[model samples]
Target: MSRHALGPEIHAQGTRFHVHSPDADRLWLCLFDAEDRETRLPMARDGKHAWSLDVPGAGEGTRYGIRVDGAYDPGAGLWFDPDKLLLDPYAAAIDRAFVYDPALAAPRGEGADTAPLMPKGVVTAPLPPVAAAPPLFRPGGLIYEVQVRGFTMLHPDIPETQRGTIAALGHPAVIDHLRRLHVSAVELMPVNAWIDERHLGPLGLRNAWGYNPVGWFALDPRLAPGGMAELRGAVAALHEAGIGVILDMVYNHDGESDAWGPTLSLRGLDARSYFRHEPDGRLINDMGTGNSIDCNHPLTQRLILDSLRHFVSAAGVDGFRFDLAPALGRLPTGFDPEAPLLQAMRADPLLSDRILIAEPWDIGPGGYQLGRFDEGWLEWNDRYRDDLRRFWRGDRCTLGSLATRLAGSSDIFGEGSRTRTVNFLAAHDGFTLADVTAYAHRHNEANGEQNRDGHGENFSWNNGVEGASANPAIQAARRRDIKALLGTLFCSRGTIMLTAGDEFGRSQQGNNNAYAQDNAIGWVDWTGRDREMEAYAFALAALRASQPDLQDVGWLTPGDVEWLDEQGQPLTVAQWEDPDRRCLAMRFRRSGLAIFVNGDDRPRSFGGVSVPARTVLPIPADQATA
Candidate 1:
């Protein structure tokens, strides 16, 4: 038996499986039947660092784990405790969570005193039958980014056990809200199996956002209380509600982290081969983490492709958004558009119709390849976020930039389908919509990294007061600004992604970077809703759903949109270039819907200067047309 024959492969029946631990003096394959009875099977030593075992009638659904013999050196990144059974990296499903055990920190077979503190990996039953594929959604799809845990964790209407699990997202209450929101896709934060940072673990904090990925092929046991069955059910429910699920995947680095990080999985198996190491054998730190994965390697590429295929064929996932996507495209001469991974994805039969999105940047050299991706892919538009923030905050000389962004950032994305731009104002990484207007600076003392962790160039305003205040004028101004931002987001000619809880004015108490705060500081406080915010959120949702022109998937011609000045006349050179001139307008007609946006802070009105006189004005979906 070898590592290749352990899991469910196309030719899994009657296959022998084995694992090789070259550094270990001894190793044993622990196999279990469907009844959870374990048997210690001896492994035969094959030449050149290989071990093998044959298990008859041990196909899919048979649970298995391994025990490796080695020293427990914390400084050298070897944490091998035979007593603490380790999981197979290729396990189809994990049945239980890892409990904190201090004994796991000690060397194995030394003393009984260190036995009780070690965490043990529990074997899971075979995976359930693959679910049927959901109805296919097209590109130019509107995605609402959300956290599976936070969406239902505090919802008063959801059941207790179902709360914060994948099954809960499919509840009628949740689906109804999504239908009302009218987004075609729900881009979930990283649900791939991940571990909280060791620093956060000691502080009793967790990585609530799930960006740190440990296993790309497995679902996080934390999010699937009922196991893979529950995840499948959630996906089915989303399909029933006409919404698709897009997973945010991390491929730039593994959870093994830096030189001093844990080696529970891949790095321990093949350190020199799995990760990119420097000339002196030091791990490459391109991801700002301890180690960057060697995506250029053929085996590594296969693993990624296998993981993606598993998610689509087994888990019923509809799409994927790659985190720090530039790392996936990095070759010898910077980011290569024809990287094997990207090309395989485009050519793969299973992934051809799926929605592909890229974060488009990393910490590596020559990383910001914004519009350099292929035509089939969409990119998270950071330019749209910055320019929109600047325009609304009254930044000088931003009118030109704002116009370019509002028209789909043609400067960055050249000539392509308008849907290539995934327009967003605030994402999970930075300030929430409320914080963008309510905090002038980041206050990340809650993250336990002092105030030095999050980004400093926020381009935010306090509306005359930082944080929260009871001042009526400031509060009113904040509400108006929020409405304007939402209006701009929905009116823009591209796919829109609204962060969850932003519609109700969710805030993190000025903690712009609360990545490690698993507590209420990062949870959505549904109790904080005000009448104005609630009404505006509903109105914005309704408007986005009702406007065909705003949601058009086609590209816009020069004559399709006309820029206007404050006095209803065409924009002049002085107005377009003036640093002080913040007022701007865009009028477009498509798919029987007309859209007009006034980006100025002050109130301005427009008349019938271009369109048909008897054309009907589009009303909100929940409102009646006059």
Candidate 2:
């Protein structure tokens, strides 16, 4: 009903297609037949930068695109040409298996017809009406992050036909695993159709992580082989099992790279308004990807909001985790907590209460907005991740930092009465929990970056061995550290997220940045999983659900949680800052839960004052309790 609804509106008799090209002099609505012949139909502009047309004969399954004639210039960032067939920025369905050709990146003056290589937009059939449901997962719930393709690719119980597809997520084996872990929600990585980076094609590597999104509306065929219906069905199945589905959305940037990249959807249609460019016309590289999207633009903001509504209203996604969220909140002046886009999302009737999480940083100027988001929005606490890793890895002078993190990052999140922290020790971009203790440094040579692609400082210890070792002592120590890390996450006072295979101790051979490793290196090895670690994780999840103090809605104070020394006494300021002390104990005042962590090599004595009684509990270095 609103003018901002700029996509194809499917009806029984015909389809009304709408697009926005502010600078276009002329626009043609082109429809392709089964034989690939194009029917050129002129479109009318509303004189306000909006173009629309209704085709009575063009109903569902109609493949159409737009051809615009306008000023074409690269330096000034006004790249528009009628010759190249441009996709609908709001296309709901695209042809499967989109193939990228280098010719598409060339200037329109090159006279290269990319229509043959371009994927067409299909007019989708009207979806059956369904009632909207309330959100399932809430604050302080366990979120299991998973990549659709890599998660079930090697699953033994899933059928070969369904393996590596969205349908596989609802499989009995997969659902059973989540149920066993007591997972409240599954945060799926990007499902949007994406193009591999231009450089990866030449190097024989593929984009395993779907971070490089090209089509914001259409699902990636490789991940969602059966399209939107399959994704909806999977969400329904997960909901039936009492698990919510949260999608990781990327609106900060697209698959379209810098000046040398392809003229795909927005770049080919209207580059000036779609992307941010400097005074000299050089594109802004805020996302560290080629061109940063100008999200503040009215049309760009409309597209993003419409896409979010579509996912929730049509695809049934329960929530969204915005990747590189600061880019979306940035304005001409600076990042605003009350940015138009963020405000629109929170005020929208369809999305207000849905779970919204932010990976609150970008590579742009002043982009690290760790805990500065609006009160209701939860953030990925990278500080919590680093502090937990450093403390559990035997780094010294970390007790003070670890104490803050264990109390829901009160120093960063401000001890507010809001659910703000999504604590995680490791995520998709870095080494696995197993690799954290089995490899000291990253080994990302497979990414074709000469071993310089991933994080240089991982704070990982190899347990005295560089790689895999047959020494049982080293292996046992690694397992102990893994347990300690998992326990720390569960006992912390906030929501927790665990990467897919981390529960079973799956490793990437120390490849921290495996975004380009599409083969076995990225897939989860289910057969060789560590069953003991899996059981331990399951136990921790059970403990978290059963205990109330671990899921505190607000930040914990000294009155709520007390830090203690090995002798069951309140830790002194000097002892808290001791560089050599690696063992600590935490006792929750109300819950009386005692967590003793010994990061040292040998056994250590731990004491805690629980229930008005000072009790000293001797905890073996191997016994890291949750």
Candidate 3:
């Protein structure tokens, strides 16, 4: 019952494609030449819902699409309206914008109206035509997490049309800012194709963060002006600026979502095999999104591996930050350190050399596997975030905790090397450095989830004021605390990640979980520049750049780093255990570079310690000794 018959002769070779509708009665392969005219080539249907059309000149710079015919069942997850054009999951470059139309989601039932919820089909541009080879800068990389749209949309200098697109990120003004900031890597939030949650769309909100992924190989047309071409151009621009690009990828689950979710791309193609299901054919909800991908399965693994290969080989991405990485390693029983996906990535020639960052936790049982990752992987140091927050917030019993975290959390990561940890005080998901010292609790009513969306245990102190205030004294205290946190993050022995707008004191107006608030709340406010915040950020970056000890690869031990009391002498057991004695000093040297950290809130005037005669301490302008 296939629509197109196999041609008498196989004239073309080395041309291939895929079709998702296995049960379809018919399928057709349509191609357009460089002039945008249809060639209407015939296709041979394979047994497994796949189709092939071989045309010698159709190899590259050719535009293609698939057409299918079948029953359109909305509730049962089968939306096979052949009348509607579909995009190929493996498309190297997308060409057009997704025009918003409700007819695309029209229900098949008689008299049923479906004009409001339909998403438009995006066209893919040919590869190599949209390809660019961007150079990589891996070693000594400083990652700055940012959102493409949010980063430039409000910037006054960016052109009106260029704002909120990948092209905007490459603007000379933007590039100059990044160069001045001294960040070597820009870890962009998820740019993979995604669907706005139905609830959000109905409520006049959008999935601003792009965490809900639908197509791994495709770039979200929403973030690009000329589709994937703009993305490639942006990467090339960043490379010209001497900055590497790291994408935040979500492979644990798809945007098709749980049972109630729509049949957009992968789910409609192969539900049972692609997704982890229950014994009764129900969806597995390990990701808290109604379905978890069966990464253990070969086909599913190939999907993920192919997606990664496409990014590196086709899109020119330098690295990836796996979101909810623990779920990818989960087996039927529990989490496996040597999961096939992990092993494959570690062994893959293309991926091994690039940076691999793991979020390291999910919502599943026994999900928190902090330090269990392999030697080559870098994990987000959640414990460091917690311990630093506690220490600066003046929580009781935090002095002991601070020491362990400052030494790279040997308790969590073991006492081998500190490079495995990615020390950070704040990231995209939670409070900014400014908000951490200004808000006591999350005010997430703006998220429309009844203030129950974000984390409850923030371990944050507002320094006596819940939110922003005009009081000079309170503002000064908050500014000092912000500097202290930045100092701790950069001074710690591990890879450091600074939130994008935190350098200039960006806040979400107390909305810790601003995933859905894509407006000014999420955008980087370039207009509002705080002199204190800028000075602190620049000072920390300069300090880290100047000191080799802060970025050391070796681990600290009792024999190397000695903790001293305020009196310039080593601490005793009783003094070390005392809760009220908040003041402590640490001295350590790495690669012949030495450093000392004073943890007390008050200044500790200790006598000069012995050091090489030529050694000098690099202090900030305000703190320099005459």
lDDT of each: 0.71, 0.84, 0.70
What residue runs in model 3 are displaced by over 4 Å at the alpha carbon?
Answer: 1-16, 20-43, 47-49, 54-86, 95-140, 415-419, 590-601, 608-626
* Residue-wise C-alpha lDDT for candidate 2, range 69-137, written one tens digit per residue: 888888888778777888898898887656667887888778677788788888887455336888889
**Candidate 3 least-lDDT 10 residues:** 609-618
lDDT minimum window of 10 residues, candidate 1:
609-618
- Per-candidate TM equals 0.87, 0.95, 0.86
TM-score of 2: 0.95
Winner on lDDT between 2 and 3 is: 2
Best by lDDT: 2
lDDT tens readout by residue for model 1, 108-184: 45524322221223334445546556435555556889888887788777898887888888999888777877778
- CA shift at 193, candidate 3, in angstroms? 1.4
Ranking by TM-score: 2, 1, 3
Taking the tens digit of each residue's C-alpha lDDT, what string does model 3 give over 1-626? Answer: 23342211122453555554565566666565555554455556666655665556444445665555565554444556545444555664445433324344444432232212323233333445324443374434467898888989889999989998888888999888787777778888998777766568656677888888766777887786576667777888898788888889998888766766655556645565567877766788888876788889766776687778767765577889999998888888899878898888878866777788899999988889888877777789899898888777776664667777767677777755323778888898888888998999999887788999888988787878899899998887787777777767766765778988888788888888888998988888888868667876786677777665566544457865666665658878787777666656666633333344444555545445322211112343334333
